[model samples]
Target: MNGTRGTIEIHLKELLEEAGLSKNKFCQRAELQRSQLNGYLNNTITRLDIDVLIRICDTLDCSISDLLEYKPG
Candidate 1:
């Protein structure tokens, strides 16, 4: 079996960290639950919501493109 999942990956945690904001701060500012945000940051989430992404982008002052990227594996 191929040990690869996909080339596309979410860089949410990196973007958030680059914003220089704590997870709690970002969650509060974005009106998002901490648990969900943690899931995203840890890459333990199975799916992502468009609304959440929009909110995160808005709060982080970053575009969706900045939150996602293609990394060949």
Candidate 2:
């Protein structure tokens, strides 16, 4: 699965793990709806809502760069 891909993915799960945050806790702290966050986790997130992203970064005490990563395919 690691090598089977088209576009490279963001390392959001790693960031969440590093922050020691569960999706439930993150949603509460970030003031986001659970379903919306689940959508992101499930890779069904079509739009990146800036406010939600900002809230998540702030709640996690991380920069946007820490929450995101880019890899070339």
Candidate 3:
């Protein structure tokens, strides 16, 4: 089998903008730390946490698909 790689892109910034929510406000509402949310917004998070994802989705009233995109590399 050939080995290939893909990327999971986080659209948190766009989603937050579209929802008219500031980063700080979102952090408060989602019960996430600013640094943690920054990691997700900047796409620098090495590990994905299910609980965090759920909180984000719940706070934004969005599905997981709306917050992430998979790109073939």
Q: Quick one: best TM-score, which candidate?
A: 3
What TM-score do all the candidates reach, one by one? 0.79, 0.72, 0.92
Per-candidate RMSD vs. true structure?
Answer: 3.1, 3.9, 3.5
lDDT of 1 by residue, 1-73 (tens): 1127555467888887788999888989999998988877766766668999899899989888888765656
What TM-score does structure 2 among the candidates reach? 0.72
Could you give candidate 3's per-residue lDDT for residues 1-73 as a string of tens digits? 0116878899999999999998889999999999999999999998889999999999999999999888887
Ranked by lDDT, top first: 3, 1, 2
Model 3 off-target regions past 4 Å?
Answer: 1-4
Candidate 3 weakest lDDT stretch, 10 residues: 1-10
Report how far residue 67 has shifted in candidate 3, in Å: 0.6
The 10-residue segment with the lowest total lDDT in model 2: 1-10
Global fold similarity of model 1 (TM-score):
0.79
Scored against the true structure, residue 54 in model 3 reaches a CA lDDT of 99
lDDT of each: 0.80, 0.72, 0.91
Each candidate structure's count of clashing pairs: 0, 0, 0
lDDT of 1 at 13: 82
State the lDDT at 18 in candidate 3: 94
What value of lDDT does candidate 3 attain over all alpha carbons?
0.91
